[model samples]
Target: MEKFKSFLKRKDIEISAKRYLIDALGAMAQGLFCSLLIGTIINTFGTQFKIPFLTSPVAVIGGTEYTAGGIASAMSGPAMSIAIGYALKCPPLVLFSLTAAGFAANALGGAGGPLAVLFIAVISAELGKAVSKETRIDILVTPLVTVMAGILLSWLIAPPLGKAAMSVGSLIMWATELQPLLMGILVAVLTGMALTLPISSAAICAALGLTGLAGGAAVAGCCAQMVGFAVMSFKENKWGGLVSQGIGTSMLQMGNIIK
Candidate 1:
């Protein structure tokens, strides 16, 4: 339909980049909650927690043991997708439809799950957007079509793409490990720059499964940016500057830094 075409036109590559990549993936996906939930809390606190539920691992037949963190990690994909859908201005039906798509893409993509969620969620959102409010029986028609289409796409496309991304990420990670000294500094600097550049370094790290020495370097780089900015702006901004840069994001001062 003409209406569908118009809706699709509205969601050009540029718009998708802004809505999915910057707003949803960067700000919300890798923001405070995710950082705490999946990053620090799950990785640090959860590991240290002595609670039975938190520490006890449940074994699956022919599969790795499931822990609290693993469960939380599984949920991250859908959560990130919903955030993307909401940012893309999807209707309730469409947004929920993306949950299914996100789960499939993330699961299929494996270690590179978030990237898959981003890509599939965008496709699913746009498809849903095309049909949003197009009919009076939107409640029925909209959801039915969106969910079906999204699931179908997930089945057809998500798995192989996810494997490919994971494969590429594995190669990069292996390379980083093989040359830790040089790669560490490079990754740290680049990921640090990415953190301040209105992009999701956390997402990138997660997508690539960047761990070990390289991950440590990446953390150092992020800390350098935050600390460097916080210290530089101490005279004028004071505590606000500290909280914003040190505890918040160095990106807050991007304009002043650029100026």
Candidate 2:
């Protein structure tokens, strides 16, 4: 255990909640933004404006043609997994191998894909790192370990994780429908609070498939936090702060909020 801790320190692999939850998870959000969010934006823009190239079919796969945006959106899992690996400072091979694991987790996990990618990617990267440079044929061993771990985890846990996440999401949605007035406030407050934390509320929303009334409440909550921070800090931060926190993220104000 001492040796392992020493090794981790040598490799700069700090094992802490802040590292995983704040750093890696935050990076995961960027991955989500790049692949899923950006893709959704492209598709929506193309469709809404009827732009020719954006709307045009770029490629065909599995008997279906996909636009550029569709292709980008479809690769969200790989993108997110890679992002997590990058954030975790994984070795080159371990980082690359996460691509396969991410795809498997996302595909198998369905609505809970993001969460699966988060967990599986972290494990696979770490496992791969463990085997990395351990042998004369390090190139072969590292990738092999990473890919196998990712594949096995996807097969074993991805589906169940997806189901569990979706179940909670469904329950939230059902409650919102059944008691719109009360659940709305509850969801709003909770999601708003989440937005201000280091954790990714968007990832949680994506994992749980938060939509309909629940989705609206979540959006409202996010907006409230953002706007609240902007307003509260206006005297100290001024307009620049207001714009950044208001439209950007109240996350930056986390320190002040804590104080």
Candidate 3:
């Protein structure tokens, strides 16, 4: 218990921020491969079975493909932001402000609008630090306040932005015929990359119009990535039994190929 507490204490905000940034970039690159993998799997299986999966919930909400990845990516960021804010002893209002800023920045950045998420994240984190007095009560209230603020802000701003992103997606799609092979390659590569990040493969599949096949491929890719990671970990440490054990469990759960 003491060792666990010490480990938790070692998780600094600066380190968290850096890790999140790396994850963001990795997610973007991996999104492309995920799309390709999903596309390929769908193409192969869709021929034999009628799969009824949707690529991402974001696509359902945004009414556009381009925003799918962003939406999926946003799902994890908020929770992480809230946790980080709490850890750093950010005030309730400040935590919410930071969340809002990060949400907006990520939303805008994913849609190719601007490179503002980093700046927003930094400012929000600093502001949170200033306002929070390092109290347990503050940590408890931070997520709630942040969530409310984020919801209000997103409600006001997301609609128009979503529409614009949809328009951009349409333009891109219209410019070329959607090719299955290309999509497959892109999805595979992206999925491989995203495995290291905190992004969703479902969103990438949606972006590529592989909604029906996303779920299956995602499960498979996740399983494959976990296996790969386990192998690598084992190679580094001869006593890495835990990694192999986890891989075995994940494989058992995700091995079934749909169709």
Which candidate number has the best lDDT? 2
Q: Give RMSD to native, each candidate.
A: 6.1, 4.7, 12.0
- What overall lDDT goes with each candidate model? 0.65, 0.79, 0.43
Q: TM-scores of all models?
A: 0.62, 0.76, 0.38
- Report the C-alpha lDDT of model 3 over 146-199, residue by residue, as the tens digit: 445445444455444544444434433432334655544444444544443333
Candidates by lDDT, descending order: 2, 1, 3
Candidate 1 local lDDT, 1-259, one digit each (tens): 8875665677432354445556655433442234324533554565676667666675453577766665565566677678777777787888887777777766676545555666777777877777778789988887777677767777777766656644444444654855668887777777666666533355567877667787788789889988998899899889977866776567555445434
For model 2, how does the per-residue alpha-carbon lDDT over 1-259 read when each residue is reduced to its tens digit? 9998988877667777776776777677667667765677788889999999999999999999989898988888899899999999998988999999989998898666777888898888888877788799998999999999999999999888877665555545555665788888878877776666543456567766777888898888889888988998999999987876776667556544434
Cα displacement (angstroms), candidate 3, residue 78, comes to 5.1
Candidates arranged by TM-score, highest first: 2, 1, 3
Q: Model 1 clash tally?
A: 0
Which 10-residue span in candidate 2 carries the lowest summed lDDT? 250-259
